[model samples]
Target: MPRPRYLLALAGLLFAGLAAALASAPRDAGSQVFSPRAVVPMVARDEGAPPPPPATPTPFAPTATPTPRPPTATPTAAQPTPTPRPPTATPTPAPSGLRLQGVNWYVNTTGTIYVMGIVVNGLSTPVELVRINVRFYNASGQLLATDTTYADVSIIPAGGSSPFWTLLLNPPPGVASVEAVLGTYSVSSRPPITGLTPTVTNIYRSSSIALRVVGTVRNDSSATYQFTRVIAAYVDSAGYVIRIETDYLEPSTLAPGQQGTFEAIFFNAPAGLETNNLLIWTTASR
Candidate 1:
């Protein structure tokens, strides 16, 4: 009996010792109980963080420079003007010499007379004649008649000439001889007429108190001619010297082999004059 009670007390002691060791040992798992009235704060911190550095401000730089420009120029003006031109002038000419050579005279019993001649000298070149003067004289040196004639006469050409003739008739009583003189005023160088023969045709006086006369004259010249102051004279039955009328004839231009006729009509003459006693006279230009 005693042994069994002793063993039971040892077992109870061993079991209490074991229970105290277990309460003091390290445990892998544990449980805890929290009260509702208790407050707990939890703060989270990052591990291994770097410290913050201080701040610094940056500085400003300078600006660039501009370039310079050049200058410009100006303009100018103009001037004035002038005028134009004109024209020129000219001149005049001169005169010339004589163209005639000679004169001739003839008479008839019926109171008819004739004069003939030719142009013997002149310019070798052709020219014109403008005027002529002539005079007639009788045997007593008495002036029977005077005349002025005009015509265009050509000069003796290089190898040629012109001929001229005139007629006169019916002389004053006691006048037996007759003469003729000629003058040429203007002439140029040209051919003239040569070798002309003249003939007197008739002479008569009108039967009137005034004793007017009529006569015929001719030109046998080869070239043209002109005559002025043609006249006729006569003696009347009363022994009075009678002077008849005068007039101008057509300008006479005689071509080769041409003939011209001239008539003289007179005024202021003596009365009862015989026709057979009448005489005519003329001067011509060549």
Candidate 2:
């Protein structure tokens, strides 16, 4: 059963051609035709034969898988946070013990009864919005009419006093007596006004004419004021208030370090009104 020698030679040539084709082709590791485990056999050699060339080391090395790490924040210097300012609140004050300091009433040319007075803050705390109540009586001690009036000053410090004026334009016939009393008020949280400094520079008063008072008020406070209300009164030599007149400064609003002027006029002047005994006062408001 010996095969033909020519057939054997042809098969050997076919195998040699395939080996040459594989040696000349390009290699793509991603999609190779041959298995990675395949290897060529070394040729047989005698003990005396020279040892085969030392195996060449591969230049390609397996790369290590990177270990993931948590992201680190850059170091930054700490900054201080400013605290917000709290809102200011107006609180109710303790009970205000107010007392009437000076009170006077008069009848003008129009038969209008004018009741004016001063309220003294008897408490140790500041008070605001002081008011006055006036009650009139006839000759028979009957109630004629009544009215309430607010103080010209909006705030009064402890032991300080403010003036109030009320009008009874229509009084019952035979109104003989009147009583001025203290009314409502509030305790204030703000400090008492000490910036309004009223200085009387001129005055005119006579028994036959109306009374006039001129003054200037300086804003000694560091804050601006929207109003500088001025009030004045003519006092007799016996210390009784003859008349009270209220006025506002010409330039009502006053900035810090500025001053304002005012003219107070009281018509139907009464006797014993003295220029030397004028009581001029002022209070600044926001």
Candidate 3:
């Protein structure tokens, strides 16, 4: 019986030791698992902190730029002006026929009188006077009286003529002088004769290389002759008149039995023997 009691005591002691060891091992294993899970959760919280400070937002930059433009043009300056030209002058005309030659004023025994002398140059054609007007003026340059008359007066058929009585005026008061005018008022104008016959003589050549011709003009009519101009024709050895020489006769007057000598010259003449014939014509007053 003693041995059986000793065996039961040993089995009881071993069961108690095994139960205590199993209980302590379970407590240490649960502590190691819980520590590793808490450490992992703490590391995750530290890694995701504040989302990295919101990434620190940067400023926006510009893309592309444009180019600049150029300036505009300016205007120019002005120019100068031009000058004007001058005008031309006119010429005067020559006087016609039937002009007043002279005037005379005198006081007679009857009353204050005026006398005037009239002249008409003879023409190549016959000229007839149809009217004559006489005007009297006083010393104060006032018109005293005017006398108008008409008559059939025949002028010599020649170029130049003498003084002829065509008008006579007698007025009263302070009469200074009388002006007499004679013209072809009612007569028709005659055609001028260009050609005439002349007698030539005494022909020679001068030292100045000019051909001198002297001629005596003969009157073709019974009335007094007045020579105006002389034209000479120069003839060569072939009997052909090649050139002409003209001479204007001023103060030309001729009587019934009187003749005038006319001289003419030619600058150009042939070396052969030559002859000259003259032609005389007239321009007279009516």
Candidate 4:
């Protein structure tokens, strides 16, 4: 026994409930799916931008300033130069007082000519080492030969004379005249050695080759006289020199007031001579 109206009402309520449930249900799975880009982060970039500068630190302490220095001075005046000097000169000696006198010549048969002359010292001092020059000439005044000779007297006193002789071995032709010249002379400034005398004895012609003369010399001076020399000269009747000879005293020295004997020989004498004259002279050291 159920009623019909109740049945129909129950059917209507069921259909209405079904329709609300269908409208209120969840959506489909295909419509809820997501994209890959939506989960990551992103940034935006600009076109023109300037870079930032590096940072600098500040100083801790203060700085100090530097000081200047002064300048030095220079000198102006310089040193002076020195000067040079000149040299000096020396002087020379003057000529002496001496002269020549009486030149003579003689010829023998053997063509040997003998030349003789005299030297005179006019100065206040004595003359030593006298040299004489003999020049031979012809009748036409042309020079033939020139000869030199020394006086046998080593020292001639003031205002005194000394004899000189030379032998020409072989003379040239036309020798008619001769001239004597004073070649050289030396005067002593020292004091004179005086008081010497010579004596001739035993005089003879020993053959024709020689004339022998023996003599003695005496020294009358106060001082000792050394190296005394004695000379002798022979002349013919015509007053021309024929021969000359020299000799030295023995011991070669004479003390105060001493005498010594000597002998001399002259060679080449002419034969048969009629008359002859002899002269003697003496010299000694100072």
- List where candidate 3 sits over 4 angstroms from the true fold: 1-197, 224-227, 236-241, 249-251, 273-286
TM-score of candidate 4 to 2 decimals:
0.56
Worst 10 residues of 3 by lDDT: 34-43
TM-score winner between candidates 1 and 4? 4
User: Which whole-number lDDT from 0 to 100 does residue 173 have in model 4?
Assistant: 82
The sequence of per-residue lDDT tens digits that candidate 1 reaches over residues 110-229 is 554433333333334543343334455544556666544443223444323333444444545443333323343333543344433333465455544333333334455555555433
Tens digits of per-residue lDDT, candidate 2, 1-286, equal: 5579989998999999999999999864322211111111112212111113336998986689788897698558877989999989989764446766446566666777666666667678888877666677765667778788877777888978787777888777766666666656777889877877888887776446567778889998888888677888765554445578888897999998998999888777654354436777778777
| Superposed Cα deviation of residue 218, candidate 3 (Å) | 2.8
lDDT of 4 by residue, 1-286 (tens): 6699998888899989999899889855322211111110001111111111223767665476556665575547765866766767667643235655444556656777666755666667786777777777776778889888876677788877688888788899877666666666666565555788778767777776666788788887787888887777665554444556778898569887888888888665555331467777777776
Tens digits of per-residue lDDT for model 3, 224-286: 545455655443332222344556543355544445567877554444324333333343221
Error of 3 at 8 (Å): 99
Query: How far does residue 157 in candidate 4 sit from its true spot (Å)?
Result: 1.0
* Model 3 TM-score (2 dp): 0.28
TM-score of each: 0.28, 0.63, 0.28, 0.56
Report the Cα lDDT for residue 188, model 3.
31
RMSD of each: 74.8, 47.1, 66.7, 67.0
Off by over 4 Å in 4: 1-99, 108-111, 236-239, 271-274
Ranking by lDDT: 2, 4, 3, 1
How many steric clashes does model 4 contain?
0
Error in Å for residue 209 of model 2: 1.5
